[model samples]
Target: MEEKIKDVLDAYTFQTTRVCRGRGAFICDTDQGMKIVKAYHRSPQRLEFEQLVKYTIRDRGYYYVDQLLPNKEGQYLNNNKDGQMYTVRDWFEGRECDVKNAADVLAAVRQLAVLHMLMRRCDLSEDRVEQFSFQDTRQIFLKRRKELRAIYSYIRQKKQWNDFEKLYMQLYSDCMQEADAALSELNQFDFDGLRKKALDERTLCHGDFNYHQVILNRKYTAVVNFDKMHYDIQVKDLYQFLRKVLEKNNWDSSLGTMIMDTYLSVRTLSEEERRVLYAMLTFPEKFWKISNRYYNSRKSWISSVNYDKLCRFKKTEGQRQDFLNIFKYAFIF
Candidate 1:
């Protein structure tokens, strides 16, 4: 560990018995327990907000959160001599939730429902309330849809094209159709009212909840990385987790059913939440993501990884459609 890190750890109350390198930080086995020390890049207020949400979850008896620990001076964030900020939080002795493993995935889903149940209506300061509120998704979707058209126009005018560009051009029409369908479906609902209701309830989403942040250990299934938590439709969290796991499993409807059933067992979804999830699934998120990355990057030398992702997305279209059909029939109807 760097001497600066040691200096920072010394500020904490725990006595560091040993230290080792972790994923992106230092793993220090201290007197209190296993703690992770990493350079914090966000503002101190953001860290304070994250800490507040985690503490709220813990206070409600969900102690599996990786909360930031305060230093000797009673501050969650501390600056080193060089003006670098560091934060130490509780770490777990476990592996990431395996999306392919049915048991692990189900457990994670159930825990997510429980977390959502507890994460609602956190008291935010008046100033931070507007800052942390959900943005207008309607305008956001229109912007992305417009950008998709722009990308198509840009690729079409190119004098020469690579394999990725050729494939993107081939798939552009179908991708736009899906995007239109998602927007159409979204327009059918009281999206504005849904946002208002969620805000009134003070629902908070894990924001970046996925298998990577879910830790599976013997004692508990721990959820980490709350840096992106914000006020929004909580089902947005469920939709994201389901899309990721289903994509990895070739969009298996059986697995999808199990996930939905598992979550429903803990907490039921309102009709609007269910519809919102289907609309979110209908969006060509993977296509948009690949295209967005391609458009933003230096295109003179395109990467094969992009081509591979495009190919995989193309190959899985049929299975994805089938799963969406089943989901709509079984859940959304």
Candidate 2:
């Protein structure tokens, strides 16, 4: 390791023995055990809130969360020479959850349900309250719908179209209809009331609960990356995990049902929450993601991968719609 990194590690209580590079961080085998050291860019207050969430969950008996360990100075952050912030967090020695594995997918969602159950009614301090506020899905849906239209317009006006743009334009109408339908469904509900309920109940969600962030091992499945934890309707996590897994499975309705049953076995969802989840599933998130990527990046040269994603997305649309229809009829009804 570089001397600057060594200096930062020295501030920690543990003596670093082996240090290796990680995804945007360093993985260190320390005297205390395995720990990950990474540069943190969020505010100290957010860091504190994250730590608090982990500590609370751990105390509540979920020991598999990623924790931001305090340094020798009783602080979770340390500044390097160039003024970059760094943090040492406990690391899990395991592979990421395999979405293709049926058993792993079920287990991952089960654990998420457990985590959500424990994350309920968290008693936040005065300072943490402002930072740990509820997320309004209505505003989120509106913003995404607006972006979808904007991207469609941007792609339509292009003088010459790449393969990716050509495919996007071909499917833009259907995809935009999906977006509008989801937004319309959302408008039928008391969304603000649901957000208020989430706040009143102090429910917490793993804001980015995809399979990538889930870690699996022999004993227990560990969830890493609590950086995105926030106060929101917990079903948001379920929707994220379910969407990713279903997309990979060609939106298999049976598999989707099993995932929902596994989650519901642990924690139940309210009627409004269920409706919100349906709306979320209806949104053309993958289409929006591809469009956003195309619009934001340099358009002169486009990656073939974008074209590939659009093809796969197009191929899966029928199955996806079937899954959504079944979900609404079977679960939401």
Report residue 311 deviation for candidate 1 (angstroms).
0.3
Tens-digit lDDT string for candidate 2 (1-333): 756578689887777888888788899988888998888888888898888888889899889988888778898898888888898888988888888888999999999999999998888864565577755777777888798789878877878888898898899889878888888888897888888777777788988898988889998899888888888888889999999999998988889999999999999888888999999999999998888888888977899988899999999999999989888988878
Error of 2 at 290 (Å): 0.4
Q: Measured by TM-score, how close is model 2 to the native structure?
A: 0.95
Model 1 residue 154 distance off true place after TM-score fit, in angstroms: 0.5
Record all residue pairs in model 2 with backbone atoms less than 3 Å apart, i.e. clashing.
Answer: none
Alpha-carbon lDDT, every model:
0.88, 0.87
Candidate 1, residue 305: lDDT: 93
TM-score on alpha carbons, each prediction: 0.97, 0.95
Best by the lDDT measure: 1
Tell me the tens digit of each residue's lDDT in model 1 across 203-313. Answer: 899998899989998889999888888888899899889999998998888999999999999999988889888888888888888999999999888989999999999
- The TM-score obtained by model 1 is 0.97
